[model samples]
Target chain A: MLSKTIKTILTISAVTFFLSACSTTSTPDSATGSSTDGSSGTSGSSATTDGSGKNSVNDGVVAPTATVFYFDFDSSVLRTDSRALLDAHAAALKASPRSVRLEGHADERGTREYNIALGERRAQAVRAYLVSRGVTSPIEVVSYGEESPAVDASNEYAWQQNRRVEIK
Target chain B: MKKVMKFSIQVIVASFLFVSALSHAELTISITKGVDNPIVIGIVPFNYTGGGPLSENVAAIVSDDLERSGQFGPIAPENMLSYPSLPQDVVFRDWRLLGSEYLVIGDISPTASGYQLVYSLFDVVSQKTILFNQPIVVARDGLRDMAHHVSDKVYEAITGIRGAFSTEIIYVEHQKKARNYRLMRADMDGARPKVLVTSKQPLLSPSWSPDGQSVAYVSFESGRPAIYIQNLATGQREKMTNFKGLNSAPSWSPDGKKLALVLSKDGNPEIYTLDIATKRFTRVTKHFGIDTEPRWTADGKGIIFTSNRGGKPQIYSVVLADGYPQRLTFEGDYNARAQLTPDGKSIIMVHRRNKVFHIATQELATGTVRILTTETDLDESPSIAPNGASLIYATKRNGKGILASVSLDAGSKFALPSTSGDVREPSWSPYF
Candidate 1:
């Protein structure tokens, strides 16, 4: 009975000690994560969401955002303005372990299967950019093809709105 | 086996009619456009020898079918001088004077088992019976189908081509709720509809089994795309594939033993064939560019698929012997969702011209691409009729997606007029 009591006391002490060490390490990491993400997110929202999107075109000062990214018709190349946002998202992910899901969509123009593949390529392009920037978060990608459009009309504005990748 | 009684008695009909009685909506067909020279036809009202109720007007349905094809103009009931029930009574001179090049007459008789339909086709100008008395018997519930068969026979006899009237169609319609879809099957004329499957996600690319007993479609019900094959008669379905990535664009082989579909499980969209019985897979495409929408050749020797490897989407065929895909379409910047014509000498695909997508057919021999539709902003999913006489496709009209059909040789156009929401993905079933 005495040995059992001692063993239980030893186990509890060990658990408490390890938990304290873990919290000590996690506090700094979480602080760094929040600081980085807050700054990056602030800059991204300010640059991309602002109506003065034209000013950032030639300066290479803009970055892509996690909210939405647009691609050219039948093309998957990342735009110049998206680079900053991609880097910001990657930096934020590196600071923390939060995962993300990227949903790819396309306009209702081309063959549905082909559009699905196109949407996939667009998502992958964004994913590749983030990974190249050294992000380690678990990012899941899905292509909805032309099935789920952001706008359900047959116009250029609607098509442009439909062709997008939603980072969640 | 219940008998339906027709009530011409005024008092009984007036009494039972309340709040427009329960009704099953049959899709109405509207021939939005007409052909240059339509053959004039006279369809006399059918004589009924049975004492049961005729649920549908057989002769009138035949006339509607002829009129909707845009190849014939049926004489109106008021314009007909006389109504004939059999070929013996059809005076060819009378029809000739009425400017009808063709005359059709039929009678329905009840047998011990069910009903028998006897029909005849007469050539008014030649003053001869083109088709002798043909007999088709069916169950009480099969009267509409039997009438459609009669229409097929009459169409073939007059037009010198096999008719597609006795076929079915499978399509996907977006339900009232967003992202909800229903996969439905109905007659070619949009009669007798049956919903095969419903999903909260998207459903697309439905292909038919060679025997018309089952269908294969792609469903996103699992929050991811997968291929499923469902048996129509048994209501039994099998999840054919659910890989880590996309499993879509299921097309059955001509022999029904295998299915060719697109799967992105291998990191990118590519053409893969799954053997239904053995559960073996064979990869048909290996390319950095997207290769999808694979369809089997008529001879089953190879597959034709859409590929963007050449900077734009085009049709390419890869035979099993060579294992190398050769480009099949070069006439347009976009030609995808290609299906082979019955003869294997032509390919029908949705083509874009002047930024408007249209249904176009390409003769592989001459490499000639002819655009077939001109009305819709985005015409897609071109499925050829089994007889290869016409095709049905999904097209946008007035901000709504609906179905339209067009002839191959003639520029005749018609629509399956619906009164509801979006209807797309019209797949012409193999003849039953």
Candidate 2:
């Protein structure tokens, strides 16, 4: 009887941990006015409200923030304006031991696979820059390939806003 | 004045007959709800100038390609009234009388070192030139390739979708005699298949770069399926993303810089992206459940992939930035191996509903869905042509895997029962 009770408790603990790891809260974009910064989240703006409404903000850990790097149309090359942002990310990552993920993106204009590769190149360029800056804490990179949009509007201005790499 | 007026009237009548003939040449492809009707098209022999018998027959190949789509019924050359080489040469009355809805006319002229092909397509009802393509040339043995170029144009202009004819499809032709799997690259019509690399071991997942110059596929030569990218020009190959556990389903990023592949190197089957230039990899999905068959959206902002995370194999999209994933499909119990249309507005995926696997297209914007294929048994791994008008997928016929294509808009569909062996993993190359 005792052993069975202990096994039940252990299984419950493991399940809770697994659930926490995959936990995501989807809040209305209208309610949360905070936009992704491309590196880490600013406290209490949007990432604060958990979708379930129970323990809206993560209790122990801070929400991940991001610093964004923007690009031109049909291009993966880092623009002149993105250099400063990339530099800041490199410095922040250097100061911390936490690993970073650079997400590459593109405006929805070209074919899907081409956009994927372009987004990858954009993230890789950011990763290479960070490595060059001596931040070596496992900078993982992936290309969203125009799947997610930072801005909801579909015009050129919004698309330009969408074509970016967010470091988190 | 009377003689001149008579000649002008004759010329106009001849021109009218020619225009009508051009219109009548088109094969009216009616794809009404996918019962497998191959589009019948006529590729008349092109008139050649200054040629010492051009080595390759460009028109015949185009006709063969259309026929092989199993969705196209190529008009017999013997039935053509006259081989109209140019627009003014066609007799509309004759072709309209013969019941051809679409007609393609092309000619080859000698260039400095090669040859140039100019082609046009006419819709029978419109009686106007519907499609016109710029001239393309090839030197010596390359005229065959120019034929493919013309095929692409005609296929696109008529269908409002890009044509995969100019693109090469790499598939594993399973030969029963030797029990060997041959990795072959064939013209989109399944002709002139040249074995690039073959193995006794099973070869799967042949993928093409956006540039169409290279192919990345999984080869089991090393006991396990390993990803390899082969350049078409020099036949130079580089072994990419071979890790422990499962390494399969290699898909290319649109820019040709990274590969979205399924690897168990980190633990279970999860999606990973490998940079071609840097040889670096980043894990995309962190699911304990199976996450495989990753494909990119046109804009490269996110990837739509197959994951059993929701209890069944369903399509999901993940933003690469922080691995934020959103479920894209919920209608079917099993949906795997999705390919996007050229416009990226819809995803054609294999959906399993009521224990039958069918090819279905879902509008990403409206969430309105319709099944494009209702094949009785398993129909999997659909790849859209570059033009997005039609799709070619693998299905089973006579217990052997064959290729089939269907026009999504026209509802025209056809099957290509392989004369050789079972063909699998058909990936349409990017438009040339």
Candidate 3:
């Protein structure tokens, strides 16, 4: 019963988004860039552009994707692998002077408060790295804890994916 | 079996001594049994002086609190024959004739800067005053608390057991019909609920210190759950744990100097204790599985917690001094929230059997488990009353969380139905 209700709500949300898109103004540059970026594939477009080099926005200006940091269960320590991703996110934030939100999240296995704290730790870990990288973009950390999940499945893999800190 | 036999013999001997006390009003209850019928008592109208229109009527609130426990039935004021402030003035015969086993009479008058209450209890049949208390002043909007003090006096005098009526209860009440949750505290009978903290996310695992002055609970206020301790009287709070991993399931040390909690700050969730004075944390357990719900022994010598290290969530005792952990529950598939009874001989916990959660008491020495909750549903967080005879816990009814209490012996039971919204994580306070 709960699943059915959620499905209905999601369907309505999708319909609303589609209807609003029809009347919304679209920039011609973004429409062309989206198709070009799609053909190049998401993973292949990492040019590692230095601030000095300006890639042609008309060729394929990919929408900046968020960097996510994953932690060990019930732990706040940033893993070794997450360092690289955090560095990349920090570099991007430095290139773009605008502020970014660090969203903290946790898996569904533990208690709520525990997850909340874990989520905050994850966001703080990413923020600390960004600060070290000279990325001064205003960082605002918010923990979704276990309330918001990256995956809906109940399996271990899904839980691991859910327990993450996303730089948005 | 041998312990039961010895307990029965002890109960008989106690009863004999009670009866031999002659004119002395003595109550001898069986150790393993409780009176199915609540004790009937009358709280006569208290004599008041010059009209200032008091802030509250303590006697009425006391009467309602006792009645709600389902342990005492207070007679209506209209049924009383006479009001007496002192023991010598009470007409015991009149109460006995009215089918009242106990009678309470008191007077409220203006004191230094506040009001003073002088109350006494009389055992109807013995014609003797069971208890007499000196006048107490209403310190500061503390009349409701004074009522609980009166409740303790009457309960102790009648049941021969200390009363938890003076204690408070911590629970989570939903706002806007479960859309939001707030941590709250109230008198044990569920009166004067005051919200301590609130958030849109869920909150859980509220634990009270042995002194009953502070509470440690988990809140998702920061978008992630974190453990926080708040002083009930001052409303002052401090965040105890917000480690990167899980920081939850806090149980205060008996001395109130530390809190035994579960934290995955190091790795997977494990048991750890935080020194309140030094703000230092010491990991107590190292395991690959989940270790949560830590509780301290009355002596503070060891800790009990739920862990899946032994393949399932079972109760385990960890020695604080030596750091040696021993499994405590072998009879149940799942057991959590181990609360030591006041006597410290048995533990009351929620045990899962046949896929239903029930409150169960297990003797530490004999490993004999007695199921206390028999209804068909989820019953968790068993917190024993200060008296150790009854306990209050949270359970599901009509798809909404509510608080229900049961006498350990199954003699009497009552439900504290919430008028606000869903209530959960009920932590019974210790006697103040």
Best-fitting candidate, measured by lDDT? Answer: 1
Per-residue lDDT for B174 in model 3? 70
Q: Give the DockQ (2 decimals) of all models.
A: 0.43, 0.01, 0.06
Per-model TM-score, in order, reads: 0.85, 0.61, 0.67
Off by over 4 Å in 2: A1-168, B1-44, B47-80, B86-88, B95-136, B155-161
Cα displacement (Å) at residue A136, model 2 = 37
Off by over 4 Å in 1: A1-66, B1-26, B51-53
DockQ, candidate 2, comes to 0.01
Cα error, residue B90 of model 2, in Å, equals: 4.0
By TM-score, is 1 or 3 better?
1
Error of 3 at B241 (Å): 2.5
Give TM-scores of the second chain, every candidate: 0.92, 0.80, 0.84
Residue B281 displacement in candidate 3 (angstroms): 2.4
Order candidates by DockQ, high to low: 1, 3, 2
Q: Which model is ahead, 1 or 3, in terms of lDDT?
A: 1
The sequence of per-residue lDDT tens digits that candidate 3 reaches over residues B1-432 is 011222322333333233223211111111222234556677776767748666666776667556545566566655567777666678777787666777888878876666788888777767776667667778757777778888877777777787777787888777655578888888776767788888787677888888888999877777555889999889899988887656677888888899988776665578888998899989899886667778888899888887767766678898888988899899867777687888989999888788667888999999999997686356877788878878987776675567788888765556666767867678888777
i-RMS for every candidate: 1.0, 13.5, 6.3
**Model 3: CA > 4 A from native:** A1-168, B1-35, B52-55, B68-71, B83-89, B176-179
Worst 10 residues of 1 chain B by lDDT: B2-11
lDDT of 2: 0.65
